[model samples]
Target chain A: MQDRYVAYAIDITDPDDPRVDNFRNLTNADRRPDRPGGKGLVIGEGTIVVERMAGTRFSPTELLGVPRKLNELQAVLQDKNVPYFCASPEVMAKIVGFHLNRGVLAVSPRPAPLHYDSVLAGARTIAVLEGIGDHENLGALFRNAAALKVDGFLLGPRCSDPLYRRSVRVSMGHVLRIPYATIDDWGTALEALAKYDFHTVALTPQHPSDTLADTIAVPKVAFFLGAEGAGLSETALRAAHRRARIPMTPGVDSLNVATAGAIAFYERSRLTEQQAK
Target chain B: MQDRYVAYAIDITDPDDPRVDNFRNLTNADRRPDRPGGKGLVIGEGTIVVERMAGTRFSPTELLGVPRKLNELQAVLQDKNVPYFCASPEVMAKIVGFHLNRGVLAVSPRPAPLHYDSVLAGARTIAVLEGIGDHENLGALFRNAAALKVDGFLLGPRCSDPLYRRSVRVSMGHVLRIPYATIDDWGTALEALAKYDFHTVALTPQHPSDTLADTIAVPKVAFFLGAEGAGLSETALRAAHRRARIPMTPGVDSLNVATAGAIAFYERSRLTEQQAK
Candidate 1:
């Protein structure tokens, strides 16, 4: 299915058609992926995101877009056996329950969950997140991780579903490409990191502490990042090889969690460059 | 208004009461602080933001919040001639046109904007933004600037108002405290940077370019950050003392504008620490 060369544009004139049910009422939480009534169908929105989905395990089962967007994405659609459900902008709005400015979307079945080992394989740098419940933050972290060269994500606990529609959209579809796995017990995850020869650093806001500059030069490291308010749990903190702050101004609150992560990731690439020289 | 010890808890039972006009119909863009009918009032939401306003020039004309939130802020409110307009949650929601989970809001007339001279004076490591129109990015950049020790912002043409309601809220009210100036002409702004002995670096995604690590150590420096797609103009690039790229994984999109700024800010502090050592 990943190597086809034809575009099948199916015209969708009615909003209530069952064939296009996957794209309906996206704003409703229950109908969105991972929600109670939803079928755990992963969704990719916009032309760029739809193109990104072509490179991931979360293949687009079907695509919905206006004719113009479908025509633009014809090359990308060739690889998916994509049944492009073409609709006028008005029909698309009614089907989605809102006017999606991106004008294109794709739906996929949630792929089987990967284990920690699969995520840890060949990973030199990773983000082990604790209690990251906001979808935007979760998504932004994935995007930052992708750009800054973080190998993957090891989910600790209380993280929102990374493949949720909003997360996929916010991540610019990188969540589907960068691998992740949820290891329920923090202790077990720490053991796995150790087994994988990964040096672990827990990122915290507490200052007068060791800064990232003090500890980021190791060849293999996993930076553990926590949520905004309540930071890393005691188990997560105690298990880490070391704790480091991102070196912030005195008296100011910590940088946004995702921003802090970007700084950490950027530092890794930077220090790595310095080392190579 | 900056120095006082009084809290006038005015009870506002009716949402339509003209006395609390500043906080009413807040969802409508026209009624928002910087909009046409908004009178350019700088608004700070939540207790932390409202408290942060006390330290900035945007003095609160009055405050509207539920009794519980008002009581929580009583000690902080003592610093201002704060007329704490108290109302129930339902009444407050009706007044603001949404359910405010933070439950507190402060409104202040937008103070006269600072000029480049005032913002650039005594500054080191500032973010000179060009064409950043998103309020959230503007607000996040301010918050990042504050947390990461960026001294101020120099706004180029096409930038949005940092004093917008959403920007204020997103900055956690740091938008009110951090100084910024709109320097209309790019050439003049470049000359001013040079006049202040600032080594200007235009941040861009183009590779084989100098990295932030190459030039962040100068005593006085300003990083020119551009919008996401249409990055810094050729004129901005040519004017800089150097051009720096925040090192990233190739082929991945550049980091979000605000996140990139944070990395630059973090690099400054890290290098400064190294210099001290």
Candidate 2:
């Protein structure tokens, strides 16, 4: 008898196969993996991200890949009963509406988003993002957070969906691992943060703010970051307990949002790690 | 008789105008601004970068832009005698082989490369790269270096040119201002760094390495960095005065090369600035 996975593997010779429709024309805005029929659907590109999807709370419903990648992903797929739509690279390219060198894809339904309290509980250090609309920046921030040991993210208004395909891929699948929640209002979030005994500091370029180094000693900290241009809104800045700036050379534009967040996280990690020692 | 400035501004209705040939089909490998006919050509995109080019050593030989951008650049162009090839957006797009929303492009011949000693002089902190092939990352490093006040770059083997159009734009034109030089051999470059009283430190993810903060107190520091995956070459690592790492969470990949460099530069900047006080 053939193994169970042998039965689950379906050959997809035609790009138009309905069985693989979920992976089709991915560049289209409406059918984006992040949104299907107004609901969220997560897509992971490449073996690494697909493995991340398999390992996380979001188990992929199906997979599309060339034979090489499918074979490589055997260990990652052993625990799941998801169907593998094996296709040629050319057919895969046709379905995806562009050439994807990664050679593998995984699709999962986006789950209910986490709540602020759920994500904040027991977390010592967290990052709060405001108006970070760029998906790549959102993704990079999560990647940096994962590497620097930030516990979670609390997103304020105008933040883009972290489950978007580009975000997932750019985060190198770390977005799947780093828990985050969206806040309905900055005021409520700030109030909640205060109750948690967290020191909330806004990262901005404005002078008269304390340097990030001087503000990193608090036990529970949530560093707030904003988009590149039109930085944190006046409301977000005024509401925070403190404002801190990453000192830099004069005459240069501020660091990229993701880079700025990474620096803050690094500084926090360094000082806190040393304090523990 | 019209003013001399009016004569300098030439209107072009055709995409194939020979006068604007240097800006033609810029996306093509042969016509790429970074390497045209095997000689370096620096290109600045958008109004901001072109304005930067105007103020730097790389003055634009000619400019191609729409009426609005041309009018905006009048002050920048006042001192220069370069011809302005004004065209409609559609015509400009056709000539460039793509829709460039930047609305303006400037081309200038690359100046002779600087020497390692020249870029290394009077530098308290500097960043050195080995085998960094990504243009965007290279550009971002310069952007970060400029912001953090790193002196300049001493490029080892396999670094991509920062004068590429994409790098210039990604760097927000900071690449044009930041001085960099290529080296023939890593051994010779490290020797020169030693004589300059530079304490060379390799930033890697390797274990048993000193934390960046521990190594930040050196008088003249040169941080050596490499590409993301294949880090600094074994030879370069062994030759460095010290090996250091930015403390990161377990099992997570190291930060992006550019981000890592930024943190190193930031740490050096923070400590040095503190010491100065």
Candidate 3:
């Protein structure tokens, strides 16, 4: 019987080695093909994210790290045959164009895009994002969604690519684990959700008739969230079946969009638990 | 009667001018006298925070900004007698050690520290921090607390200074408006909260027998939260009247401490709204 996981360790001392080009200048946005302005590979940082990548459908084609990180990830890589380029901390930093304190990185080609229907197949709770252009917010939203049992995400128009490097890192590699799809046609997406019996709740700070807690007791919920300052566009808000608010103080500004989403997700989880009880 | 609000603009082109010294080297941690390690001034950046400072008890002794921001903030600074040290963007950037795109700043001497009793006075909901040493998290927690109507903050041992520049910026200047105090003795502080008829709930990911929603109905509630990775210490957990959790998925790590606190705060607000209805 052949071993299922095999890690080929290659030691490269040279910073300019062509073999390590995939890991070069990771901080440079222009180098990332996955970003809106650039064309580069998807990259994962640190041992934990690398381990997650190994388990996800988005398989890492290559890895670069120091010996310690390699040792830390040995168990995760045991069955999967992947090239692990091991280098000294100094050499690794020089090659990556930054001092990566995480000390390990995994690079994977973009996978085939998941369809909205495929991602929503069995999801009872879903998050819909519009114009969430900030990478950090996008990542944190994914992290919150996963922790709160939000089954999947559907990106509306103007949202940033979740596969962006910063988003991947901020999501703590959960972006690779949770399935997501882009909604090219907002109206069609809403129609599909409605057809699936989803209670489409638009989260807005302005003119919300219902509080988030009041809207969570449903069979299936799809929350529509927008960026912090310019909340859900009029078109997006009109498309939803209901409008819900998190219920905040009168004078204070709305909560951070990611935090607001987490609160909504938590409310949904709480309602579900109560129902079970 | 003379108008109480007046803006005194002093044009400063020289970065070395002594009048603008308080805003100099804004990014250098070593120069901050307000921090544990340094003796510097409390700084507020951008027009919104400056406006907040003008309204708060921590009165800005001096302010610096560009002409455009000065015009935008005229109403807020109209009654305050604080000197507005106007400067060109280039000079301001050179003095502050970076390009402050906000184009405005205000510096205030650390005001007399508020006693825990004073901060807790007339407060129905409050957040307590233990071992929350991160500036960004501390700031975000304050922002969430304010927006969610958590009236005050009580800092336990090992908590970072909420007035730090990064924290102030991250809080969108809410730290200035929200009153907080340091807990010299956790035991006494807990006793004080009890004396004031407040239910002290310690937020912990481990051994939490109750969910947050179950514990929010008391006349007053004080939520005790710890740092992200370490969570609430055993001593802190044992000190509280109850241990509560945010109810997350099984396999994922606990939510970010600030996010967890926001959820807890939101739950408290939700329960309060239900009671009112």
TM-score of chain B of 2: 0.94
Q: Global lDDT for candidate 1?
A: 0.85
Q: TM-score for model 1?
A: 0.96
In model 2, the Cα lDDT at residue A142 comes to: 94
- In model 1, what are the clashing residue pairs, if there are any? none
Model 3, span A1-277: residue lDDT tens: 6432258888989999999988888778775554476655789998878888987777788999887787788788887778889899999989988888998999888877888888788889999999999999999999999899899999988998888889999898999998999886698788778777888999998874698877779899999999999998999899888899988889788899999999999999989998998
lDDT agreement with native, every candidate: 0.85, 0.86, 0.87
Candidate 2 lDDT tens digits, A1-277: 5243631688999899999888888876564434466446788999888888877877889999888787778787887777999889999999999999999999898788888888889999999889899999999999999999899999888898888889998899999998888896888888879888889889999977998888879899999898998999898898878899887988788999999999999999999979989
Local distance difference test, candidate 3: 0.87
lDDT of 1 by residue, A1-277 (tens): 4422256778889899999998889887675445577788888999888888887898788988888887678777665566888898999999999998999999888888998899998988999999999999999999999999898999888888888889988898999999999887787888889889999998987643588877878989999999998888888887888889877777787777899899889888878888898
Candidate 3 CAPRI grade: high
DockQ, Cα level, model 3: 0.88
Ranking by lDDT: 3, 2, 1
- lDDT for A132 in candidate 3 is 96
Candidate 3 Cα misplacement greater than 4 A, ranges: A1-6, A34-39, B1-6, B34-37
**RMSD, model 2, all Cα superposed?**
2.3
TM-scores for all candidates: the values are: 0.96, 0.96, 0.96
Rate residue A60 of model 2 by lDDT: 88
Measured as a fraction from 0 to 1, the native contacts recovered by model 2 come to: 0.85
Misplaced by over 4 Å in model 2 are A1-7, A32-39, B1-7, B31-39
